[model samples]
Target: MREGWEYKKLGEVCCPKNKIQRAARCFDSSDKILYIDISSIDNTMQKVTDITSVTFGDAPSRAQQKIEYGDIVVSTVRPNLKNIAIIDRYEPNIVASSGFCVLRNTECIERNYLFHYVTSDIFTQHLMKITTGANYPAVRDQDVRDSIIPLPPKSTQLAIVSELDNIKE
Candidate 1:
């Protein structure tokens, strides 16, 4: 833990939004939007590197929670499992599984820093505490909204991200 880096809940930095719930439309080969499910992410890295098969008409007509480049996507349903990913590309559309939480740092918070923190042991522990249910665990929208996070200056966040990247390399 570093100075000025406080613990904030996942909700403090992001809002929860799901793709419009409607009947799954018939799949068409020509559909434009790319469908990325939890399976698309690599188990260890939780990052999406390859998308082999694409299905059409599966996307919501009104995609309210589109994922943009640099945004962090977290799986809320099983926070203890620490399933998460950071979007580094500028995609026209990105939707996640119903249990996932999309976090958009409001420029004040560093997306990369938040991305790493969400997968840390400490954060995962916190999520486990907040999550409800035993057999079928679940975290609600309000639960994420009230989550606390450390608010650091941009420079510090950049440094943390750079350091983490180097360590990864």
Candidate 2:
């Protein structure tokens, strides 16, 4: 840990709220909704690339995680594969599969920084160790919330993210 840096539980830095799960019958069949499943994300790109547009009646039972732009959705299953993506853009009626744990940044942490941290090897390795199930290993949402993260000043976080973005380009 560097000076001015502190280790904080992810739940403290990022608040994961809006756990609204509606039954498929709650929505109208004529209404179209943008559905994002764990598989629809291209983790390498760090963005949601593919999504399905379906009527609420056609939505899968797992399509109950509501998402907004800038939210970070990470697949709780198979954390080693690093299925994570930031919700950069979406239609007004966008919902994600329940397999994902959505993270919303707080004032203490930058959104991009939180996204980068969750997708890093450090985080994934930690998850790999605690995740159960040999064939379909997965961690609970509380596991992700309880994990600790190193948080620096917002300015420093932005600088680090900018440099990483440059390297990607």
Candidate 3:
């Protein structure tokens, strides 16, 4: 660990998850959204490779998580597959499947830094430990919230994210 770095639970550095309607409460036929599902993420590339356009009338039951730009979405199901990505360019109609645990950064932490932390092998292994079900191993959203994150100062975080993003490119 760095001399000035600290550790915080992910939930501590992230905004509280807003409570949204869990089910198909109501939707007009004309209402539509760009939905990112587990399949939408190319885990190998750590990017959203496919976004399905769906109208509210035919929206998947799991398309309930509204994400904003800079938010991180980690797949709760099949944590080993590492389906995670940051919402780099969100629009009003962007929503992700509830299978993803959406993470919105608090002021203290940089969003890109948080994204990099979760993409680590350590993070995936931690989730694997809490994963349940033999046929469908998965972690709950709460499990993801409880994970630990290493926090450097904002400047250090930016440097780390920048280096990693350059490598990614």
Candidate 4:
């Protein structure tokens, strides 16, 4: 909706990368990294609970995205903005499902910016238009990778994130 912001698909700005859970192994109950599944992620921002575990043997081939503090992890299946979350210090090493679309941030776009942008009415409307499914209403990984967004100045993006943070506080 703002100037300089161009319409793009989720894939162009993001890689939609994924890691496969290994086979011929079982993860025990006490594993360290939190295993995130569709059920583990709520459609709305909520306390992350119901986490499972992935053993060293079962750990994903490689972490699809290094989910650092402030990064946003979006669920690809239902493809709802409310399900997005800003990674925090409290969030330890974790791996999400293949059904999850991990957005790698860029110099032109900050993580917080992507979070808000994806959740915005403008982007959501576009997302709704692109997504297809009668029951699942899914958006493909390729579609996500090609998605475009308004390219704002870095300082402006930081300021916006700050304002949003204040509101949350």
lDDT of 3 by residue, 1-169 (tens): 8899999989888988764333344446577878899999999989998988889668887888767788889999999999999887757677789899989888999888888899999999999999999999999898999998989999999999999999978
Off by over 4 Å in 1: 1-12, 15-31, 49-56, 59-64
Q: Give a tens-digit lDDT track for model 4, residues 33-92.
A: 666666765555633456666564465653243354555666667665446665564554
Question: Which candidate ranks first by lDDT, i.e. highest?
Answer: 3
RMSD of 3: 2.2
Off by over 4 Å in 2: 18-29
Model 2 deviation from native, Cα RMSD in Å: 2.0
In candidate 1 the C-alpha lDDT for residue 82 amounts to 64
lDDT of 1 by residue, 45-135 (tens): 8687654334445454422244667667677677776667887767654545555567777656777788887778877787788889888
lDDT of each: 0.64, 0.84, 0.86, 0.62
Better of 2 and 4 by TM-score: 2
* Better structure of 1 and 4 per TM-score: 1
- Using TM-score as the measure, the top candidate is 2
Count clashing residue pairs per candidate: 5, 0, 0, 15
Local error of candidate 4 at 90, Å?
Answer: 7.1
lDDT (10s digit) by residue, model 2, range 1-169: 8998999988888765544344353457678889999889887876788999998778898888767788889899999989899888845678889898888888899998898899899999999999999999999988998999998888999999998779878
With candidate 4 superimposed using the best TM-score fit, by how many Å does residue 7's alpha carbon deviate from the native?
Answer: 5.7
Error of 4 at 19 (Å): 10
All candidates: TM-score: 0.74, 0.91, 0.90, 0.69
Model 3: pairs clashing at backbone N, Cα or C within 3 Å: none
